[model samples]
Target: MNTPQQTESIKNLVENIDKGNIVLPEFQRDFVWEIKKTCELFDSIVRDIFIGSIIYGKPTFEITVREIDTRPRKGQGSRRKLKITSFDKGEINQKSQISNFRLILDGQQRATSFYRALKGIDEIWFIAKSEDDLDNEIKTKEYKDRSLEEMLYTFSLQEDEERISIKLSEAYEISKGDMFDEDIKENFFDNLLFVVAMNDAELKDNFRRYKTLCMKLGELFKSELLLSYYLLNMDNEKFALFFERSNSKGIQLNFIDILAAKLYKGFNLRDKIDELESRYPNFKFDREIIVRTISYIVSNGKDIDRNYILSNLNYDHFNLYWDDICKYYNQVLDFLFQEDLAISQNWMPYENMVIPLIIFLRESNQNDFSQMNEWQYEFIKYWYWASILSQRYSSGSNEAILQDSNVLKSIAKGIKITDRVFFTRLKSQIDSYEDIFSYSRKVNVIYKGILNLINYNSMGLTDWNNSSKLSFSKKLEDHHIFPKEYIKQQFKNDEQAISLMDCVANRTLIPKITNIKVGKKKPSRYMTELKASNEKLDSTLKEHLVPTEIVEGLYDEFFNEFIEERAKLIFDLIKKTIIEKEKQIIDQYYLAPRVQGNIKIFATYYSKKLEATLDVDSQKVLLLGESHSVSSAADKAKYTLSGKGDTSTNGWRFWKYIDNNGQERYIDEFRK
Candidate 1:
């Protein structure tokens, strides 16, 4: 076995530019450092604080970095030599002289950040604070209230043909909203007039603060930046292993990142996720779902720990099924939309639910649920609400998934499920309308779920503005029933006041235009504005699920009574909607027991062909005494006729009619 070589070396900003030996690998992500962080990094370096280490692999051949995406070039790969060159903003450049390169396995971000700041790429600077002035600032609390750049002298050394001009500047624009009464720049350079050119005869004193700051900055540049590096021999496999483990302190390496490095494809898994995510812009594709999904099917319902998942996975296993996973998972997304479960992947309360969902859907019946029965739909609904209302996936997530995956697998195989504990537990929960802030501007799972329930149930809000369509998703803003001011007046403690003011029961999504008109008014006062017709206000209130009778004279009732009564009303509304609407969805859309005695049509090269007789009650089509579901029957006919599956054949074209002397058609139509 060949042992890997490891070592450490220090390199300064000048050496990095002059040699250009350190370069990032193609696997490294793009640089995203902002100007503020650049300032902090430069300050840490000048104060001699340790930033961290960089790891490098000494390869046989140096590879150029992918061209950085920026305004100069719009995300295009660069063919340039990719070496850093030394050039002052106003002066000529010097080319690098060294040849041997170190492929950066880690710390590419830190290096790029340093390069940008040192090169003044984004106009970041180091604060040149003297020891005495720094102490004075700390004592006066100047450092506390003001930015480092504002309280102290900051300079950038710009060199021309002859001498370096030490220019004074302020970083107030880049400062994080910290302003000082006194302008540090006013008469800042007064003492430094020709201080560099002054002889001993013309010098006022060499101890002037600005002169000392310039001297410190000039000396600081010559010193090397501290960077600890592990020097590894050229090996792609070893480099990948090190890179995956390198980010243990931060966000650990995702399976996609490791898989990409292992697979070495033209486009990475992230790009594929991006492509899938683009197809459904409203939904966020959780990377863990992708990994867990692949793991679930590959393991055949067995559970795997997060850390060991990548180790067990091989390139062949992923490549073979990745494309199918992408397609089938998209169908899963479409299924979610069809179900109306109040799920937004972006604001999902329990994203863990999606893992088992995709796995079960992908595992069952040719990786789709289009031919599903009524019981399957009911099971899916129960699975969704059970996972949501109960904390089934929140704790012991691995154990829960393992158990749930087994149950779902059994169901998909047409096995009878007698167990009902999970669904029963979810249904038994009496505590609904849990407290969530109305003051929140962000869309959370609870709020989004509430809105989804309303929309799915088709219960439109009663409003003064007349409109045919209820565009609630865009039109609604969260409205507080009890104004914050009223709540504040009711409670002596400020914190207690806000708790009642922002609670979920006190809020509802109403039209934004109405919200603007109502603007901070008490709910009692605005109640009249919500009534559109002569219908009693209480009747309208039931439609919106507002606790009108309780909130009408809410001032009379104590705050606690108000909360309790409104919470009960909200709970009842949710319970009624979910329980009743589910039956409606099943009764109207259930296709398992589809209507029978209809003529079935199939697409052909010349014309239509009758394939099978529909027996909707049995949920099967009979062809030559062979039973098949609607779609499968059509597939069988097309395949037997042409040796191909014409999946595009419209199965819904089945028609029932008395025709001109109508008798049963299907197989008889071909005889005609």
Candidate 2:
């Protein structure tokens, strides 16, 4: 229960560093440090200790001593004292205590060299030995020149004279027979200490002090010994914190940090996601999207509250999500790689499209999204985020929207639907289905916003460099369709007339070269040139819209008709798609459904602002309408004054009614 403090001395600790005795904990890394780094570490320690440079500033290292039953040699068993040193919180005790107690935690190369050199193997030798033996073979710089010293330093040996009698295991010489050459030994030791000194000084001065310590130690110790502190003595909460804070130099750790430690041996998670995403270069989502998608799949598509889902996800539950990790990975594969759903000619609004992908996966019998289930909510999420940011910066570019995690989170929470209605105060006139149909067809401003972009850019400009520019295939550059000169020419002396040309609806993109080519031309002339040089257009225009041939046939009259007809068509298409999607959502989910009937309908007294419902089929000629249809009764209505039945009947009249909470109340004067 007591908090652990860093152990101070190599003699006071009691962990066995026997190769067989050392056990790597499930949470620790495998023994991955190489000979070069190990050597450098030892050199840094000796240089600092002897040169009095406390390169590693804060007394961060500690070693403890422990006694264990010595191996039963050919003769007998004895209690041997083990010297275990703590470096970077990992304990590396002496495998078998060498006799004299001159411990070097940082300079492992020098210590290892001393042990090997003294064994007196005839085939292997060191530089600067006190006495030379002709029988001891030393490596030469060249076969002709044998001047390189093959002995440990004269000063080092003298300094350790008193502590020099320790006997190294006989196995050392047997393993390194004839392999220890002078150049190899020198280069290895020099690099080891250089890194240690650099690491030590860097840690003390930097913000990443804790992380540097862990990296240095993980490099120095084998996992079997390192795991003792991280797993045996550490609590889960504390361990999670430690693991997160211990990432390498440049990595910014997150929930995926812990997962890395857990899955390092089996899967390369980041690489897997990166490779998968390369397939969908158009794909856009933060790290959280991947985590959430897997969580949803693993939970069997449980409709968990949005907030709860994110909070509960962690490395521990990763196994729960593992079942679908492969599936999600593969589906991402299908969408990105196999389907080639790149952002070349098609622009799918991800906010509304990504959701469908998840629904596809959840409802399908197959592990991946079913072939029948089109890209759903997940795909919409991707498109929506991209579009939201793209639309936000239609005029300019700022990463403010891109970096705002909150906006992305809002996207994740999704659209919050309600049952509020429009026609609540109703004394109806024509309460019939046919009347409702007439009302549904009315054009509204809401429809305008949705369709105008397509009409002006997609349809009207089809003959004028008409590409799949409608898809927003690349970075959006708002183009001025009726360039400034045209606006001035069309409206000779009106300030407000030219101002309308700057609206977002008029701005669309063309290939920069094409835009420049068509510069300053009349809309008709621009259309003609664009039609002639069709090579520079998008390949998928036909798929997203009607035939290019049809667009060509109507090119002369398209821009004019586009202002009146195509815009409305686009708006209607948007409305129909939205309504159908909403209904699909309600049918597939919406656990509770309630109806309210205490409502009435009212019509506006003047102006062309038609109420949410009321038939305008027989009426004609009017101003603009509502932003969009609102009534629970009829989808839309318009006010007009020219056709057969306009001013003759009240322009504002209710045909049928439904309440604010989705309850129908058909007009029945007979019942009253």
TM-score of each: 0.43, 0.31
lDDT of 2 by residue, 1-672 (tens): 153432221111112223323222222222222222222233322222121111111222443432122322111221122233333332332422321122323423222332222232111211122111211244212212333212222122111111111111211322233434344233332232212322232323221322222223222222222112333344333344343444558665654555555555655567656765575565443444555455544453432222234345555565555435445544643453223332322233222223334434444434653443232444343333323322322211111222122222222334222211111111121122111111111122121223233432233333235544333234333355555576667555654344344433344434455567757665555654666667644343333232343335443323333233323443344444333344454443223223233223433222222324222331222224433222222222322311111111111122234433232332221011
Could you give candidate 1's per-residue lDDT for residues 590-624 as a string of tens digits? 23322345444333321334445655445456776
The lDDT per prediction is 0.48, 0.32
User: Highest lDDT, which number?
Assistant: 1
> Worst 10-residue stretch by lDDT in candidate 2?
157-166
Model 1 Cα shift for residue 254 (angstroms) = 4.5
RMSD of each: 29.8, 34.4
The superposed Cα distance between candidate 2 and the true structure at residue 181, in angstroms, equals 94
Pairs that clash in candidate 1:
none
